[model samples]
Each structure stands twice: as C-alpha cells, then as structure tokens.
Target: MATFDARQMQSLTGLQATARTFLMVGFTVVETVALGLWLALVQGAPVISRPAAIGLGVLTVGLVVEHVLTDATVNGLSFSFPLARIVGISVSEALLWAVWLGIADRLGGVDGILVAGAVLSVLLVPQHSVEDNILRGEAPLSNVVNLNTIGFSLVEGIGATVWLLLVFEGQQFAGLLATLGFGGVDPAAVGLAALGIFLLVEHDIGVTLARQG
Candidate 1:
C-alpha cells in the first residue's frame, strides 16, 4: 500500500483544486460557444466556421458534467466556519458567470453575447433554485443558506449588467466591440432585452417555488 505524507497530501489537494478550476474554465467556454452557435443557427445565420461548429458540438456534453460537478463540490465542502461556505459558493457562481461573459464576448458581438448569456442564465436559474431549496431543507435555520443563494444571485445579475454596459456603451472599455461583430442594430436595446429576459425567468422560478412550498 502507498501512503502520502502531510506535504504530499497537501500538494495532491492543490493539484486537484487546480485541475477543477481548469475544468470549470474549459467547460464554461464550451457552454458559451455551444450557446452562441445554437442562437446563430436559430437566427438562420451561417456564422460559425466549420471547425468551430465541430468543436462546439463535442464540447456540448461537458455542460451538464460541469454544472453537476460545481453543485457537488460546493455542497461537499466541510467548512467549519459558516462564512467559508457562503463565500466559497458565492465566489464559485460569480466566477462561473464571469467565464461565460468572457467567452460569449469572444464568440459573438456584445448583443449576441448578451442574448446567449441570458439564455444560459435562464436555463441554470432553476437548477440553482432547486439547490437552494435542498439546502434550506437540510438546515432550515441556517441563515448562510439564504445568504449564499441571494448573494450569488445578486452577483450574477450585477456582473452581467456591468458587462453589458461595458461592451455596448462604448468600445473604449474593452475596445473589441468592432472585432466581435457588435454593430448592427441598437446594442442598448439588445442589452435591455437580455436584462428583461433574465429577470423574468428568475421571477418565474421564484413564483413557482413559492407555490410549491
């Protein structure tokens, strides 16, 4: 039998964390591209290249895998401090959406990217809401449960809104708007639509959950 010393175990854990982070980043990219392709195809736009299309198809499988892993990893943590868990989960969700924004901007223009992200956000909001319900069930008195859910939700919403303004208001922010195909219709209108869709989906989930309970 082989055993690891304290330092060896620490090193192994570090490597595992690094690997998980990389996987999160990679899968987020895959999901973003897949979403953008889906939107483009639906719009009857022959936009994505053949190579990009093939890569995105293969990467689509990772979306579910990554989402499951993220939920499990956060719920599996053994944090003695209440704040640790809240912070961990909050940061994880924020970073996940941040990666989505970065990749979306690369895949399409700001408007298209916002639409794709809004779709992804709507798709995942129910999953997170379910997770929140499970957590409340397990620890009904835990304020951290509510805090984590609300905090992460706020972070995601604010992050997306800020990204929309940064990209659409002017190219001076990121300075890549032209290259990303962000110049057809009014980007401001697209941003507003994205924000409205996100809010509507989130509100719908909340109302459904409330009725269920």
Candidate 2:
C-alpha cells in the first residue's frame, strides 16, 4: 500500500534481483519434487478426493485471470491509455486468497504456497526453451506475461519481507534470509525441475521437458 516512485526499488534491488533469478530457479526444482510426491496423497485425502482436483482446475484458470487482472490493478487508465487490468487483478487476488484459504484448511496451506511459488519460479526465470517453444508454436510466453510476472513477484517478495520485518520480531540472521527468500533463480534445469513438477502432477511431463539429444 506504500507508494513507490519505482527508482528506489531499482536501486535497492537490482543486484539482489539479478541474484534471485538463480535462487528462484533452485526453489522451483525443490517444489516440483515435493508436489509430485504429495499430489497423489492429496488426491486420496477424504476431504480433497475428486473435489480437490476440480478445485485445482479452477485455481489454474484463476492463475491465468490473475495475469490479466494484475496489469489493470497496477497501471490503471492513465491520461493516455486506460489499463483495465486492475479489475482483473483485484478479482483474481480475492479469488485466489479465498480458494487458497479454503483449500489450505484441508490440503496444508504450504501446498498452495508451493504451487504459487512454483508457477512464479517458472515464469520468473529466463528459460532457454522459450525460444524453442515459440518456434514450435506450442506455448509461447508473451512478453507481457513474462514482464508482469517478474514485476509482480519482485514487488510481492519485497513487500512481504517489509511487512514481516515490521510486524514480526525475529533474529537478524533469520530475518536476513527470510527477507531474501523471494530472491530469483537461474532458468536452467534447476528451474525446470522446480516447475516441471506442476506439469508432472497434472501428468504432463512431455510439456515441461523436451528431448535434447
């Protein structure tokens, strides 16, 4: 809710941002593995059986909508162009929060967070295969999608860290790492491993991985 002139963030975080790329990728790999192991369990749980998959399907749609909404939320109609993304973002956020909370009650909130973190990890890091995908006409990530996801994740990480620093009392060492946790990661196999879990969870390994000799 704080107003940022934008310049300050760049100065405060460019180096960290560059470094986070690597971290994000690493985080993604860990998440992929965790999800694979957990998805089957979650599906079999009494509370989540069948219905949870339906819920996840809904959440996936929400993720796409969140993309559109975030833009409208951030850059509203200026004197020049009316960015209508805010409405979408506001709605998406509310829905995701509600869905996450509801599902978390049964599914372990950590899983929800993991899913979000994993998705962002994939979108955040710069992957080499994007070019191959674009050429193949499979699923080309547009510039807008990539840019907005990066901006959103970067700001969200910083904002949450600031809030934690203010509200929570903790050791300086713990705080430092927590503050830096939103750090990004590299866009290599590590990052792929992280995100690939989601694909695998949905039984779509072929989508995440391409045969390279």
Model 1: per-residue Cα lDDT over 130-188, one tens digit each? 44554334442333233324534553454455446644444444335446566553554
Which one wins on lDDT?
A: 1
- CA lDDT, every model vs. true structure: 0.46, 0.35
What TM-score against the true fold does each predicted structure earn? 0.39, 0.25
lDDT of 2 by residue, 1-213 (tens): 244657767766775544434433443333344333333234344544665555444543444343232222222213432223323333443343334334434344434444443443343333323322332334544422433234434433232223222222223335454465622422222233433443323211222232222
RMSD for each model, in Å, please?
13.0, 16.0
Ten residues in a row with the worst lDDT in model 1? 38-47
Q: Could you tally the backbone clashes for each prediction?
A: 0, 22
List where candidate 2 sits over 4 angstroms from the true fold: 1-83, 109-144, 147-213
